[model samples]
Target: MSAPKVLVVLTSHDKLGDTGKPTGWYLSEFAHPYDVLNSASVSLTVASPRGGLSPVDPSSIDAAKDDSISTNFINSPSTKPLFEQTLPLSDFVGNPSAIAPFAAIFFPGGHGPMFDLATDPQSQQLIREFWDAGKVVAAVCHGPAALVNVKLADGSHLLKGRKVTGFTNEEEDMVQLSKFMPFMLEDKLKEAVGPEGAFEKAPSAWGEKVVVDAEGRLITGQNPASATGVGKAILKAISS
Candidate 1:
């Protein structure tokens, strides 16, 4: 069989919070998974809601260049080509019939996701399509915030009965930026989704926590640190 095709979605936000300060994609969010998936020969595509030149966090890139995975992803001739090209969001708009091109959809997280993905109607629709298609739908950190508004055609939550985890409230609090965040993601998820609906998480910073609700083909990671774990989980789902 052909290599599994995976679509990696990212945030194109060029600014952080209300302060309008500059910001970019978190490194580990993309680098870690990009390497793991690339080595597996998965056909990968990177797209952002706003598209065009997904920004790499300055710190992440600096730190990654020294790390094994990051250095490999950057120096490898094959993966390096993606760093130069990215698909535009306009290509995904209202193309439900075209959604079948991918075997799975993965979203990497960073504060930037809170800026655009948290409420984009198109991104929500795309996610619904993935879930409906019975393909893997995975997100990490703030990437799960994008699920807050995704609903299937039947009006049920896309994640209604699925056990999933994301950046926890304690993690946010630890970052010392919880108060300034646009919304408490963990709280809103519990309130809207419910007690039995969500999964458990460990108390750790950038810990490797990933939840895969066997019934729904939905997977989630707790933070940037869970990127590789999340990628491995998605690979399992795709192969299954």
Candidate 2:
């Protein structure tokens, strides 16, 4: 049998809410999870909305000071090319055959996700397909924003009846970008999940929080600090 394949989706978006500041995928959000998955013999395909070189949030890389794993992922020769050569989302969305090989998908977040992935129609479709195929769907930080708009065959929101978490309202407040994002991620998540799907949050903004709802094909993390937990959950689901 072939190695377990995973699709690691990244955000190509830059520019944080017209502030002209650069914002893109958080390095550790992708790096930590990727390292864990890689060690598990998972092969990852990196894809982004715009393709080509996906931008890394400068602040994210800088903040990963104590995290050598993330630092190594950014600077290591083996991982450098993967980060630079992201396939376009259209490549997968335009050709179903191209997306057929993956057993699971992961979305790693930075503020950029709030700008694009949250409403990308193609992303919504891909996510629905993966869910219906009984594959694992996981995200961290602002990543869950992408799931808020996904709908299933029965015409119900994907997040409905599921328990999940993402970058909370307080986190946004702490960063002072709550007003800048296109939509409040927490509010959108709550709206999508409905009463049946409880959208809960971590008590603290930077807490390590993750939730796995097998029936919903969902795994989510509260913030960047939760990325490793999200990765472990994805690996557990895949292994199980």
How large is the C-alpha RMSD of every model relative to the true structure? 2.1, 1.3
TM-score of each: 0.90, 0.96
**Global CA lDDT of candidate 2, please?**
0.88
What lDDT does each candidate get? 0.77, 0.88
Q: What lDDT score is found at residue 136 in candidate 2?
A: 90
Candidate 2 lDDT trough over 10 residues, lowest sum: 90-99
lDDT of 2 by residue, 1-240 (tens): 888889988888889988999999899999999989999999999988888888889999999988999999999988887769998888877466786898888999999888889888888888888887788999999999889899998998888878989999999999898888899888998898888878777776798999989653689999988999998988888777
Candidate 1 lDDT, 157-192, residue by residue in tens: 776766778888888899787866789877766665
Highest TM-score, which number? 2
Off by over 4 Å in 1: 63-65, 74-84
The TM-score of predicted model 1 comes to: 0.90
